[model samples]
Target: MGEVDIFKIMKEAEKRKKIKEKPILVKKVEIKEILPCLTTPGYIRFTAQADREIADVIPIIFLMFPPGKTNYSVKENTLTLRAFNRMITFFPNGKIAVTNTRDKQEAEEILQKIIDIINEAYRSYLKYGKPSKETIEAAAKLSWMDIYNSLPKTNCGECGYQTCSAFAVSLLQGETKLSKCKPLKGEYFKNLERLKQKIGEIMLNTLGWE
Candidate 1:
């Protein structure tokens, strides 16, 4: 049996306690308006307000959105994404709109979930420092065809896509892994290197971010 250090155990517990005690950036949100959701005929949209600005957290929350469903405008200081079966829009001043929910309670619950997302991103920022600035335009400029041409084009079905073109589409959507192509690790190794250069870090790291 290993000797346990009681002081070390107490220090670890204090560290976790301090983390839990950290104040949340978004304590609560108040629903300001409710309207029929234009995009989804049967759903409702609720606009809400937060206690503080959350613009800085957008980059960290990018992956929280469904693949291919996110758009961010640094110039406009806004982010829009479809996630959790809802369309959500965010602004720098803490204004938020969420569609596909009904009534105040439902709206608050959904916004609370958003707060959780924000808290998660905030924690990461505090722990790791700010994320590196990515070349969003580069990812935006990439076409599925560009990815398709760079692939082995074997249509091997090892990646679960029926055709190389389909896989390319999935890759562009950030829905599929480049390593899943299989042949890239073997016969098509050079093509893999070429793809890395063309696609840059987004594809190389399989983050699919822009």
Candidate 2:
């Protein structure tokens, strides 16, 4: 008879346990298109496709869209918004388009993060006939136009920008604050406050922070 080698057996069991507990990294995503950004210099656009069917998630995304930075069209079955400083569009065919990425590496990273959300939404839909509201709300964020429209439109240069649109873009980039808009008041201030809240919520939701 041979020795049992109990230590080796235990080590093997522990390795298997750790492997089982580790999350499975998604590998079924493919980057479909990579293009230069026409509107924004030094940025690129990436279009990606997931192997699994995600048509079921489009409507849930539309329903849970957060205010300000998000736009959803039920007729088109599409949702367009900003996330991680990139413009993203969720389509009905399990495909997504993200613009304004810094580079291919950054685009890939963003797609992975996006795929994580998609997987969560798909799983939720399969199990409960609905996607998680938190996931959808976290994924969608405000665009520059969304923020600009809510500003005073004074172009007062109090925010150190030649135009309110430029200031709105800066706010999205975290380069400035709403407080810098000295002339902002009344309804514009109220809108600005609400947009800020939404942006904060999205940051917390996506970054896994409280």
Candidate 3:
């Protein structure tokens, strides 16, 4: 068979195996509504669904409320919800990072119902908050200089610049493009692209971006 046919057959075999596996079934719950928190930058929302139990021992179930603001938190379980102008944190689990927010009685009511629904499903684990400052700083230390050096140093000015070093500095400052390094075509270009993504993630998670 051709390479394409071989690949297709492999995919089909994988699908069959997945389908044969037993599925975990949990009780489902419905969410009536969620209230808004105005204190934070983003809105808070809640959902009622089948969630894992808190622990094998505990009978407590959980409902998840997520913050609309991406920069505020990263943990999926705990969230900072905004109610009007104030934001509240809630923790469904015992973890440090996990927290929940609810501003009004109506929101609290919705959260309780969501917790009930999740209890019907699988066991739940504690959630944690965002990474610590030290962890973020470590990630930033990885640096973008290596990728910068790999670029072509021709200084041909094809990318509308005077020198490669100048462009690199600009890239670091978020002023110029990595592609502006004319020599970074082919595999080197792709590698630089990957580096860019990694650097961006580090900057966003650790340094905090605008």
Model 3 residue 158 CA deviation in Å: 1.8
lDDT of 2 by residue, 1-210 (tens): 999999999999999997566443234778988889877898898789877655677655443333345576645768786667767898877688888888889887888788766655555455556544443443354566877877888787877899999987766555666667766544466774565455444332332222
Off by over 4 Å in 3: 1-139, 142-144, 190-210
Q: Each prediction's Cα lDDT score?
A: 0.73, 0.65, 0.41
* Cand. 3 TM to true fold: 0.28
Q: How does candidate 2 score on lDDT?
A: 0.65
19-72 per-residue lDDT for model 3 (tens digits): 555243233333434545334444454434324332321211211211122222
Best by TM-score: 1
Which regions of candidate 2 are displaced past 4 Å? 1-27, 63-65, 131-210
Q: Give the number of colliding residue pairs in candidate 2.
A: 2
Tell me the deviation in Å of residue 92 in model 3: 16
The candidate scoring highest on lDDT is 1
TM-score between model 2 and native: 0.50
